[model samples]
Target: MEQPAATYPVHGPSLRKRRMALGLTVQEAADKAGISRSYLQRLETGIRERMGPKRYTRLRTALNATNDQISPPPEIPTEER
Candidate 1:
């Protein structure tokens, strides 16, 4: 039998939704993603908006999330030095 495609929650555009969908606590998800809990929390709460490729890949891999299920990291503005 073909397995059904995984569907992550779309209630909100934050990592928290995906974490909650999988019934994983922040610490658990962070550990799985190989990141600090505070970093993950920042991403979930929109305290931070951009993620580097390494971090993004880690989160996606940890969550087993499809491209659509995860929000792409928005481009960060260059500092006006």
Candidate 2:
């Protein structure tokens, strides 16, 4: 049997950069964002499973991230038979 390839969420780098630019620590940002420190850490490390639109919006707003600072994942083309 062959194993499946691994996939990682894309928000980690954006989150880390925004937090750093704001001169905020992980705990501070997490607290301001109403999420747990460990949860934020995991998200920042790409260890979290996935991200939804709502969560992305919230994180973006909470971090005061600009549009250029955050980008949605590229769309996967659909297959047609």
Q: Give the winner by TM-score.
A: 1
Segments in model 1 whose C-alpha atoms lie over 4 Å from true places: 1-12, 72-81
Model 2, 1-81: lDDT tens digits are 975334324467777888999999999988787778998898888787455655655666788986556554568999999
Q: What local distance difference test score does each model get? A: 0.74, 0.73
TM-score of each: 0.69, 0.64
Instruction: Please give the lDDT score for candidate 2.
Output: 0.73
Name the regions of candidate 2 deviating beyond 4 angstroms. 1-9, 72-81
Model 2: lowest-lDDT 10 consecutive positions:
2-11
Q: Give me candidate 2's TM-score against the actual structure.
A: 0.64
What local lDDT score does residue 39 receive in model 1, on the 0 to 100 scale? Answer: 82
Most accurate candidate by lDDT? 1
Candidate 1 per-residue lDDT over residues 4-40, each given as its tens digit: 3343222125567788889999999999999999988
